[model samples]
Target chain A: MVKAVINGIPIEVEEGVTILDAARKAQINIPTLCKHPDLTSSASCGICVVKLKKNNRMFRACCTPIEEGMEIITHDPEIIEIRRTVVELILSNHPNDCLKCGRNNNCELQKLVADFGIREEHFDKFVRDIPKDSSTGTIVLEASKCIKCGRCVDVCQNMQDVWALSFLERGIHTRISPAGDIKLADSPCVRCGQCSEHCPTGAIFEFDETSKVWEGLMDPEKYCVVQIAPAVRVSIGESFGFQPGVNLTKKTYALLRRLGFKAVFDTSFGADVTIMEEASEFVERFVHKKGTLPLITTCCPAWVDFMEKFHPDMIDHFSSCKSPHEIMGVLSKTYFAREKKIDPEKVFMVSIMPCTAKKYEITRTDEMFASGYQDIDVVLTTRELARMVKQAGLDFAQLPEEEPDHVLGDYTGGGVIFGATGGVMEAALRTAYYLVTEKQFPKVEFENVRGLKGVKETSIKIDDTKVNIAIAHGLSNVEYVLNKIREAKKNNQPMPYHFIEVMACPGGCVGGGGQPYGVTDAIRTLRSKGLYAHDDAMKLRCSHDNPFVQKLYNEFLGKPLGKRSHELLHTDYKARPVYRK
Target chain B: METSVVPDIANVVEKWKDKKGNLIMILHEIQNQYGYVPREISFQLSKLLDVPLARIYEVLTFYNYFKLKPPGKYTVSVCMGTACYLKGAPELLEELHHILGIKEGETTKDGMFQLEIVRCLGCCGLAPVVKIGNKIYGGLKRSDIVNLLSQYSKEGAPVAQPV
Candidate 1:
């Protein structure tokens, strides 16, 4: 361990640790715009500059390694001024249209300005003729508000390993955007929202369907059904001024009801169906040698798109099943509509998701309901829905707790965990373990697979068979696993893992692209907490235990992978066009 | 949402009172028909899809890949994957940016070129490759960009239809 003093506070940290990391460990506040925990620290923005008093030297805290007995001045007047000047230069080219921008209070650049008290404009700002790009249909790119901070580029390249964006042009014309300055959609963005998730300004944002959802509420003839993902309950509360880890599913459901949704459904129900279909598919894949060995979960759209567009050879590995939200959407139209006898056409199935990728998932053409209608109508991020709830003048906190409507509402704890990283793997393991052994797991919590680390791998023997499973949340992590897979193939080695679980955004659907814009690592813990809390609070915690799902199989589905089940539940994946460049 | 991926425009309008999913299908139709979603097409489809223009606009801007304008005859894209980026892909894009005099996703003034950057083309071996329509140009250099673009059209003119 290395010992160091930062801002006069002493601390011990691991070797090769940066001064910024050491300062963070000592509870010292060293500001940074270019340093993300998961990114390769570039120290480009120069905002984390600190003076090493002993050596009488200054260095970027993000890149500088902490030495023994090193004394640092983090907030010296000269340092503050230098940092402020750097920020001023960044602001000089940025658009000051904060009020009109979508990321008003949620912008990182704005947050930095707020933190430093740079209220008065110290520099002239430029207004570009470039309007925002909405082509992606899943994100908003208002280049006018960009600070040219390469954090987005860093995350896209170093973290997610997608690298669709870059720093183009130099000097005042300098801009951070996708390659060739082309709109994002025409590229293989996969709509991960990590770039927007890490963007410090409203330059990028999730597509807003609040207005359409509001219209749905006002439509007298439409039966508006809303579904909330498990991660939303924890994160949405923050937008309402609540602290992280505060689970408020009941209140959120009640508030959705107050917002005029005809019926409120929990995405956990769809998650339950996902486990059933997924586990059954796994069984078939093993027993019948059908599909790929160790079928991967397709619940996360970001991962699905990544596999489809970039790794078409691995498409066979992805489970040919719709995500939980899409499954719920189909159920709402086919079953709920038939039950209500309302023209299925009049039912507006609005999915309140925690993912930005859900916006893209609903657009797949090969999926059914294409003969003329979209099954899943619209999607709003948890934050957007909270805004709508507040826009309606309701006190979200004080609203009396209400239960989700029956049937579509109730879900097991296993299903609820589908929102968190490694959740699908754990959920599938919980059921698969029992299905193989016909006995309960000695340990229900698969501690091996759960955590904040982007990727995790484990091998457990189930039913005298070694089941190797891998779970990855962020794109970077998934890329690492794929690289390993390729290396193994090159060496003519046996594939070690049987199943892989990947989410587009780090930490899974709870830490999704469309969630509230608190893109901090802090938000991941909070959202995952919300997901697990909901899981722990639920009565039925196993996929097979959902009585309603059992009834679904007996009365409707007829059995997992049955002709009727395939007709209603399963879907295929397409080898999406790989725009080779 | 009519519980369909693509809904008939007339049926959607007749059921417009609550036809929530019509806009998605309409947007898909527009995107499928054109190489990209043009803003004008979205405006027209908004009425047919029964979606408000502002709402359609919001959806268009949210996703990274959706475009709001006309694309070009031959879409030239560079793979910006990490393997590509480390191998001078960004610099190659800079070269194209200079040669094309337009950023990614924009049509040339004459509507003959559209330059873009995709995530990964799954060609780790050909790190600095560019794709023009279905043709892939491998092992590119900054100097070869102008001549590379000449294959599509003359310096400033649109590529006239071969027919």
Candidate 2:
């Protein structure tokens, strides 16, 4: 351990810990803008400048490691002046359209300026006249609002390994853009929105489709119906003054009804149906030797798009199941419409997801139009729903807890855990074991495959045979797992694993690109805990045990992987060009 | 939109394949050959080098040395450094535009000449300098631009020395 004195307070920290972290241990708040808990500090923003006691040399607290017996002064009059000048320079170039920005109240830079008590502009305003790029239709890039902090570039290049965004120039002329001044849609971007999620300012943000949803809600002829993803329930509470990861599923159902939805459904129920088809498909591939080994999960749309572009050779390994929300969408227009006697054409199916990629997934393939109409009419992120609740002037905290509709609302504990990494693997295993053994596994919880680990590998015993499984989250971590499969194929060796699960965003959908802003590893843990607690509280813990799913198969659709299920619940994928041009 | 890789460009890309941080050097070579980095070459280089086209473009556009469009037969550059600007460089540029029927950073319809504005060509001793290809004319007036164009038109080709 290294001992350091921060602001006259003595503290002991592990060796190589940054002074910012040491000050945090001493309970001193060192302000920062470019530093995020999820990324390595680039020290681009000089807001966290500090002084060493012996030589009085100035250093950035974020990147400077604490030395043994070193004395550091985090804040003083001189330090405050330097930090203020840094912020003033950044503000001079930043746009003054905060009130009209998409990240109006939730912006990091705006909060920092307010904290520093900056009342007036100290420098002459010289904002750039760069035009906005809304080519992706899922995320918008307002280049003028960028502070040139390089956080978004780090997340895109280093974290996500997408390299779709980069600094176009050096010094003051530097602006964030896709390579070659091309539109983002024409670049190699998968529309994950991780760049937007990591941006400290309003420069990058999810495309606002709330106004279109509002128009559909106000139309008298349109029967507006909405479904909520499992991840949305845990994270939406952050916008309502509740702690992060507080489960508001029932209250959200009541709120959606108040917001004028004809019926509210749970995406977890669609997840249960997905498990039924996916687990059966796994059995066919693993036990029956029907198709490719190591069947990869196809729940996350961003992962699907990434696979289609970067790893097209692995297309044979991808499961044919549509994502849960798309399944819910097609079902809403078909089974729900037939059951409720509503016209499929008039049903405006809206999906509240913790994903921006869902907006792109709605028109991704022709199977998305399986119900003879557009499956999902509109897709809104968890942040957008929070905005609508505020716009409606509804008191979300005071609303009594209610239930979702009967047929499509009921879900199992296995379905609820789909929001976290390795969740789909655990849920699928619970049913895959039953299909192989024809009996309950007794212990349904697979503790081996749960957590925030980048890649998790485990094995389960079914009867006398051992089933190998692997799960990976975050797109960068996927390369290692895929390389193993490619190596095996090259050597003509036995398959490494029977099943694989991949989620594009880190920590799965709970830490998705369209979740609430200011997410960290701690926040991901809390959100994962919320889903697990909800899962543990439920009576049915397995997907095959959900009675409503069975009823849907018996009454409306046939069995799992049957003719009707194939027509509506399954889809195909093809290789796509990296650039759209 | 035509992204088929040419054999010569492919050879150039292959030469730089093993070198670290060779994007700028390779782009310089492309610019030297074609007078500018064409869109098709940029796309093909992205595929051949396995680098994101965005990253390549970021390097290509960030420096003022790289161009994206084809240059004309005779390239004209007006130095707009502090010394040249104070000596009425804008008037000279306006007159050149009038004679060539093209704006800065553009080629004439006849493909005879292209106009550009640059910072210091290291000849500040001769303030208000204009360079056509390898020949440099220093201390020029607005009226001199017409005479300069007439000399080139009469020769029907670029002269090795300034008139």
Most accurate candidate by TM-score: 2
Interface RMSDs of the predictions, in order, are 12.7, 1.6
Flag regions of model 1 displaced more than 4 Å.
Answer: A1-15, A24-27, A54-56, A368-372, A437-439, A483-494, B1-163
lDDT of 2: 0.91
Per-residue alpha-carbon lDDT of candidate 2 for residues A253-322, written as tens digits (9 for 90 to 100): 9999999998999999999999999999999998899999899999999899999989999999999999
| TM-score, A chain, model 1 | 0.93
Model 2 chain A poorest 10 in a row by lDDT: A179-188
For model 1, how does the per-residue alpha-carbon lDDT over A233-343 read when each residue is reduced to its tens digit?
Answer: 778888888986688889988888888888899888888888988987887786557877657889888778778876787777778777888888877887667667878
Q: Give the alpha-carbon lDDT of every model.
A: 0.77, 0.91
Please give the TM-score that candidate 1 achieves against the real structure. 0.76
TM-score of chain B of 1: 0.77
